[model samples]
Target: MPVPHERTSKKKFYRSPGGAARVTYIRGKSGRHHCAYCGGLLHGVPHSKGVAGTRALSRSQRRPSALFAGKLCTRCRATAVEEAAKVKSGFKAAEAVELSLKPFVLEAMARVE
Candidate 1:
């Protein structure tokens, strides 16, 4: 029987040289990170086995350096920047921005210019 920590792990059987079957437990992998805005898979992010494995990585390896890198995809980031620029320049109203994009647009507006 597996220990309490490994109770949920998958089991595999292998034949040994002595003709005895050996069982091995395999732990499940963590899910990939997705973008908050586009629901696309995030790039440049490592999927570690658990919290300790993730903590072992450097900050740069854990997430990208770009603004909102881990949270938003490149395409959505670009759109947010464009919308923020238009809103800042009086071409678009803040209220007219899409509900999902409003927070991103506001954040970009404050940071860009």
Candidate 2:
């Protein structure tokens, strides 16, 4: 890729009030996207593809494209998977505790009584 020539700013009027700054554009430059998880440059390539059939019976049951749809970048995604595996393997899955309004209702009933 060719480097763009150095840009020179235009002279501003002394008496005029400033509204917006001038926008500059290079001939061949385009916007680049970064990773969703790590905020690193994605460059030109996508996340890696793991060996086939590794997740054939996985509970998540999502396609590889769907799984990596968020563009997390391979390294960060790997680290996240490692952390999740550590948590999942070391501990049993806990049931979600439902929040109930029964306590508030009981308090109100007591106040009424």
Candidate 3:
């Protein structure tokens, strides 16, 4: 039988539209704290003992982008950016040209309202 949505007390964060391509994490498991930049598990073997310290120090310490592997799902993010570009703004087309390509920013804006 297929595993139920909330198996083993794990909470699932499904991809928008809520289905497959979903990601779930158990409270005390490696996936419990995944990197916000990439979906990779943040705290566990091969990774730091815990990201809490790294995440906190990141604000003060310089970090290289190579750490996150630059892997991100641009599907929804691209849509949000397209939606924002549809509006006129003082940010100017030239400046926005760059922000428009940032997956997290674009996609995040799209989901709002």
Top TM-score: which candidate number? Answer: 1
lDDT of 3 by residue, 1-113 (tens): 44764466666666867565776665643334444444544332233435675565554242333322223334433443454555434344534544534555445455544
59-84 in candidate 1: lDDT tens per residue?
88888999888889899999999999
Give the 10-residue window scoring lowest on summed lDDT in candidate 1: 1-10
Query: In model 3, which regions exceed 4 Å deviation?
Result: 1-27, 32-49, 56-72, 89-113
> Each model's TM-score?
0.78, 0.33, 0.26
Q: What is the C-alpha RMSD of each candidate to the true structure, in Å?
A: 3.4, 19.0, 15.5
Please tell me which model should have the higher lDDT, number 1 or number 3: 1
- Note the clash tally of each candidate: 0, 0, 1
**Residues 1-113, model 2: lDDT tens digits:** 32335343333334324665654443342345566656776644322323343345453443234323335566755554444443445542312111242332233234332
Q: How far off is model 1, as Cα RMSD?
A: 3.4
lDDT of 1 at 72: 90
Which sequence of candidate numbers ranks them by TM-score, best first?
1, 2, 3
- Deviation of model 1 at 37, angstroms: 1.1
* Leading candidate by lDDT: 1
